[model samples]
Structure formats: structure tokens, C-alpha cells
Target: MPGIVPRGRRGPEVAGTGEDDSVWAEGQVRTITDLARLAGVSAGTVSRALAGNTLVNARTRERIQQLARSHGFQLNQMASNLRRQKTGVVGVAIPLGHDRRQQISDGFFMTLLGHLADELTQRGYDLMLRRVLPERDEDWLSRFSGSGMVDGLIVIGQSDQFERIEAAAAEYLPMVVWGNHQEGQRHCVVGTDNRLGGRLAAERLIAAGATRLAFFGDAEPMEFAARFAGACDVAARAGVSILACPTSLSVEPMTREIAHHLHSNAGGFDGIFAATDTIAVACLKALRDAGRAVPGHVRLVGFDDLPIASQTSPPLTTIRQDIAAGARALVDLLMRRLGGENTESLVMPPRLIARGTA
Candidate 1:
């Protein structure tokens, strides 16, 4: 019986039955109940301590955790899930583009994803990214948030799928979206004030004495739509005309479209407001190709203030979104819903970062 140990508690000096008996045995501490008995606490207290619940006194939680660690005891996640009826995981979903096959390769998505991973980890929740094609996956939301695999969901894009998102919300799905707020919307949303960002970009250019202006970026994405609307509003109020030049999410196509717009409207625009930094970068290239000078010939403003915005020659003047704050808001809202609390949609204000481009 070399592997066998005593069944019950033993004296301090008992051979092979003290703190040294760390390996799993038939009668050793294995369950929360067993660990609770050894730690002189209730099974409920042990559960809360293991979950990092703040209700347990700090010292008590530490002592119980230390005892569990010393005895090589780990909670069974499956059993724990069954007990709490929670998966302890958060699902993050990003909608595919209109092409249905485009991966989320944009810098904005990458930066937001990184911040989300960090915030979710710090909150003791595991992140599970669910990439879905709306065209192929009609019930993507249910499959992701209702599969008993996650406690809540965070959806990144709200393109033309707002209706489906609203439907899911009506069904009481615990989720949040990272996009613009719209009329009659019911889902919890965390996003920038895109309209304000757009308006500010237009107004700044106007104040800089640029009359003829152009707004770039496709309006298919609802967020960009809001930004475009804002820019148009400002242009209309100031008695300035804004030429709407639509561009796609992809770079090459967007560049071509921008170049076409610029070429066709040659000598028409002296300022431009791009819905995103990527679009602004493309505009820069197009303008350079057309032999137009920046700031002097065309005062440009972009949104998102991405890293490349600062690195570009005659750095991009852009609207900055508080990405870290947005991530925190999204996670906090979802967690609150998971905790049975009613949460409202949060909108972070946008700031205009003045640079050489404007």
C-alpha cells in the first residue's frame, strides 16, 4: 500500500499523513466539502473564496486558498458550473464584413480586442472570441450566448444587423454592442459619439477657413453613418458644401475610390474628413499621387487617431476615441447584466486631436 494514506485526520507526527501528503488519495481532500472541513470553514465560504468573491473576509479567503493549494486541491469547473449555473466565461463576437469572409484585420479591431482581453482577464472572466458570418449564421447570437458556454456576450460590429441584435435583446440575451446608438434600439451599447466626432472634424476644418470640403468612408457601417451625418450637419449649418465620397473597408479598393473621387472633383475640395484613420491614410496616398499638398492644398481630419495617425508625414489631425474606457464600459455593462442589474448604454465623448494634417 505504498500509495495509500490514512483515511481520516492524523496527528502532526503521523508518517506520510501530514502536509507532505499532497497527492490525491481515495479519502483525501478532493471536494470543496472536504477542503472546507480541513480549513475549518463552510463549503459555501470555500466556494466564494475560490471564486474570488469579495464577500469572504480577506484573511479567511487567503487561509482557505493556501490550505487548498498545500493539499493540491482544485475545484472541478464542470461541477462548479452546474452548481452556479454559470460558465464563468464571456463570449466576444465580431461580425464579418459584407463579403462574409473578411477577417477582422483592421487596426481598430486589433487594438480593441487587445484591450478587451486585458480587461476581461483582470475581471476573473475568460474570453472566448466567436467570429461569425451573419450571412451563414442566422442564429449566431443564440449559438454563442445561449449555448451554456458563456455567461454573457460582447458584439463588436452592428452594421446592418441592428434588427437581429434588437431581436436578441428583446429575447433577454445578456449582451452589449460596440456601435452607435439609434432610435428604438434596446440593446446595451458602448461606443463613441460618432456624430459629434464627425461634426467636430467638419467644424474644425471650416474654422481653419476651408470652404469646399469632402467626407470620406463608406456609410454601410452604422457607426460611420453617424459620423457622416454629423459632418454633413456641420457643413450644412456653415453654408459649406460637403462631397460624400464612399469607400469600402478594404484599403486598395478604398484608395481607388478616393482617387477617383479626388480626380473627378479636382479643384473642388480644399478640406476632407475621413471616417477612420485607415481611410485618411488612403486619402493621403491618393493626394500624394495627384500631387496635392496636405494642409496647404487639403486640410484633412480623420477619426480613431490610430497609431499610424501620428506616424504619417505631417501627422493626421483626427478624432480620438477612448478605446480603453470603451472596453471597460462594455465589460462592466455586460457584467452588470450578468449580475442581474439593469444597465444603460454608455457613450464616450470624442476628442479632436489637432495635428499637422489640419
Candidate 2:
């Protein structure tokens, strides 16, 4: 045949031969083993060459690659990963223990996730996202950690399952969380100093001449709670009263809740410190509907200085959490942990972005 090539001692072989290749032929090359036979090299050498491993000389690698292309051979990545005991995947879990209704599409989360995807992709890893409700599944962490689908994990938000995360951290090293960091926590964490951010928001409201302050947002989550506590600290020292007007993060409920708070406590609080920019923006609209003026009647401040903060009327005066920096730290710390290194939690400082609301 025109396509036949001499294989020296092995005799001549026809190109593109299938299973029915006569007893004289060695059959078609469709896998690494088949390619190795045709290339007169060991399967290990063929695998290394196909993977572009420098251990295989450039000459042999190029020859194997050419042979693979000619025979239409393809390496099974899944099978290869299994043999190497690596998935080349990083799992990102968002545990909504405090608010199960919170979606991954939420502004703050989407922003952080975008940065995370960028960081992970730059490092040659794939991202696998999972939104988990820790309340419904107590073993959510264990299941994800034990599953061989991902090589490492990055958890967003501690929510109310701090204890569960602590337990998992004790056993899982390749895990990093984004939340408030305590003095003696075991898990590696990367997040803003929410308490300090809260202090900054409260101080700005106070400086803007507001005495009575109300914190808007659910304070049950660790991050929110820290912020509330910080604001409370400032309020206490300044001899000003601060109240917690519990609000949900869900859009529909948050809108209604802010309106209700405005209606119920019309003149109770002159300064409002929202835990998130999302809540602060809603509160601003509610204040307008209630015929209250910003700074003239009420001074408002929010956290997480999201993009929407600047777009708001009178631009929101809020605490800016470096979400991009936090995301980078999370991936960097997780990569370190994956390398068997014990990394400490990273707490990035929050800056006050003075716009116009406060």
C-alpha cells in the first residue's frame, strides 16, 4: 500500500489500519499504548512525551507528537489525571448558612467570584463553583473535601457554620475561607477587617453630626456581626445610641424591610449604617420615599463599597473592602496550603471612601 511504512524487524505496517488489519499488521494507533508500539518506545516514555515533560528529550517528544498527530491518537486527560492523583481543579464553595436564599449572583459575591476565576485561571487551574446551605447539609464541607473532583477548596463566607468550618479545617489543610478571623481560629482565612470597617462607617456618620444610629442588615453572620460590633464600639465611646434593624439580603424582602423600618422608626434614628452597600442603596430609596433628605434629615453609610455605591444619588459614603485583593489572597493562601504549608489568615484593612451620603 502507498501508506505502508517499514518498521524494520516488526515488518511493514499500513497507516490508519483498524481492528480488521490482517494478521500481518499491528492494528491501528488510537491510544498512548498503540502510539508507543508504532514509535518503538515504552508507554511511559510516550506518556511523558505527549505531556511535554522535559524528562523526555525534545527530539523524542517531537517525534512522539508527530506520530500521535499522524495516527490521530489522543491522550485521555481524565485517565491521566487519575494516574497522577490530581484533578487540576479548585472548588469554590459559598456556604449560605445564615441566609440560604442568598444567590451566587449577589453583587458582592459575583464581584469576588469574577476576581477568583481570574486568579485561578492565571495559575493554570480550573474553578468548580458550589453554593451550599450548611444548615440543610451538615457534612457539606466533608463531602466536598473528600470528593476527588477538586484538588483544593476556597470557601466564601463563614456564615453561621463557624464551628463546622473549624472542624473541617482541623482535618483539611488545602482549604481557605473568606470571613472574619478570630484570635485562635484554625482555618486559613482571607477577608476584610469588618469590625474596623464598621468603626469607620459609624465614626463618619457621627462626624457628619448624627447622634442616633441604626445598623441595617442581618447581624447573625460572623462578618456582619463583626461590623455591627465595631459600630457599636464607636457608638458607645461617643455616647450615641445605636440600634440593629435586622434586614435580609434577599432583594424583595430587603426592599420591603427597609421601607418598613423607615415607616416604623421614622424619627428614631438620624444616622443609618448599612452592613452592605446593597442594603444602603435600598435604604436611601426608602428614605426618599419617606420624604427624608440625606444629610439634611438622615446620614447613611454602607460597607463593601461596591460599584453601585458611586452610582447612587449623592454617592454613598461607605467603607471600602478591597474585594479584589481579598480574592487574590484567598487563591494565594489556598495554593500555599496545597503545597503542605501552614499559612496564617490574612486580614486586609478597610478604607473609608467619603463620597456624599454621610
If scored against the real structure, what TM-score would every candidate get? 0.81, 0.90
CA RMSD of each candidate after superposition: 6.4, 6.0
Give lDDT per model, in order. Answer: 0.86, 0.90
| lDDT score, candidate 1 | 0.86
Give the CA lDDT, 0 to 100, for residue 352 in model 2.
98
lDDT tens digits, residue span 198-222, model 1:
9999999998778998888878888
Best by lDDT: 2
Error (Å) of candidate 2 at residue 111 is: 0.7
Candidate 2 lDDT: 0.90
Residue ranges of candidate 1 with Cα displaced over 4 Å: 1-74, 97-103
Clashing pairs in 1: none
